[model samples]
Target: MFGLTFEKLLLIGVIAAFLIGPDKLPHYAQQLGKLVRNMRDYANGAKDRVRDEMGPEFDDVDWQKLDPRQYDPRRIIRDALTDEPEAAPAAPSPNPNSAYLQHRAKQQALATGELPPFDNEAT
Candidate 1:
């Protein structure tokens, strides 16, 4: 399960048989089987206990969304960076000397080849 393919397992088994010899092989193999069974039982029991405690909410959970393997830092960052900001409110400005009006006037003057207004007191 931990990246050990059939050939690798076979090689490992052959090496174990040679090192342990035929005399005590059966005893060791039986012990190994018991250990594997115990580990499996422990995992199953833990899962069952959690399910029992969680009740119906366990089934309702979106397991895939919670999975860490599905997360990509680069994709998350890219999406965040590319997302557009919400448009500002369309309410009319009450102030006559607003920066938006000043900017618009400057843009209009520039388009008509006229000098833009300069306020020395602005700085």
Candidate 2:
């Protein structure tokens, strides 16, 4: 189909006839016809094979279901993601107090490093 037109082909044929003369045009045409026939047969056979193997299910299936160009892969993945819950934003650290509490902790540990009587040792 290659955008071939009757006028363009006729032009090509006129040139071929002049260049190759009346001796080989018929032979080339026959060969071209055979090539086209073989291509059509191959395509038909492939289609028949798929239809036979897939059976009624294939026939009944919506054609759009098989069209890769029209499929939305994201829809399936998005559905799967939506099925899971967002982890409750990590429970904020048990101790929300920062700088002051952290410093007090360090001081407590240091003052009681090797002693048991240290709950009131810092004072």
Candidate 3:
């Protein structure tokens, strides 16, 4: 805590206001406000940079693990695709009858020119 007392701070403020007048005091205060905001922004950017470079390990790795700032999107994608064993999808080429059965019902209707059932209110 810099050991800065309230009395000392008040005295400094009083002196600054007296020396710099009322009109210029407002302008000086505005500039000081801008400097404080810029410092805060720089600090946040630096923190993010350090987090990304350190990876998932580090003491401040709370958010980094739950929702990481992606350094490499391709790496994440690659891991997601290959990490888990996938259920082999039933392919159509090897079993020819399955494919035929899928289309047979549709083919029969088309040949008869039956146009399927219609709904009056649909239009």
Using lDDT as the measure, the top candidate is 1
How large an RMSD does model 1 have?
A: 14.3
Models sorted by lDDT, best on top: 1, 3, 2
Q: Write the per-residue lDDT of candidate 1 for residues 1-123, one digit (tens) a residue.
A: 899999999999999999999999999999999999999999999999999999989899998899999875544543454444333337744773454354455453365676778999998
CA-only RMSD, every prediction: 14.3, 17.7, 17.1
Residues 3-102 of candidate 3: C-alpha lDDT, one tens digit per residue? 8799988999999999999989999999999999999999998988887888766565566657656554544443455545344444534653543354
lDDT of each: 0.76, 0.69, 0.69
As a whole number from 0 to 100, the lDDT of residue 25 in candidate 3 is: 98
Error of 3 at 113 (Å): 99
TM-score, prediction 3: 0.45
Worst 10 residues of 3 by lDDT: 83-92
- Of candidate 2, the 10-residue stretch with the lowest lDDT total is 83-92
lDDT agreement of model 2 with the native: 0.69
Candidate 1, poorest ten consecutive residues by summed lDDT: 80-89
The best candidate in terms of TM-score? 1
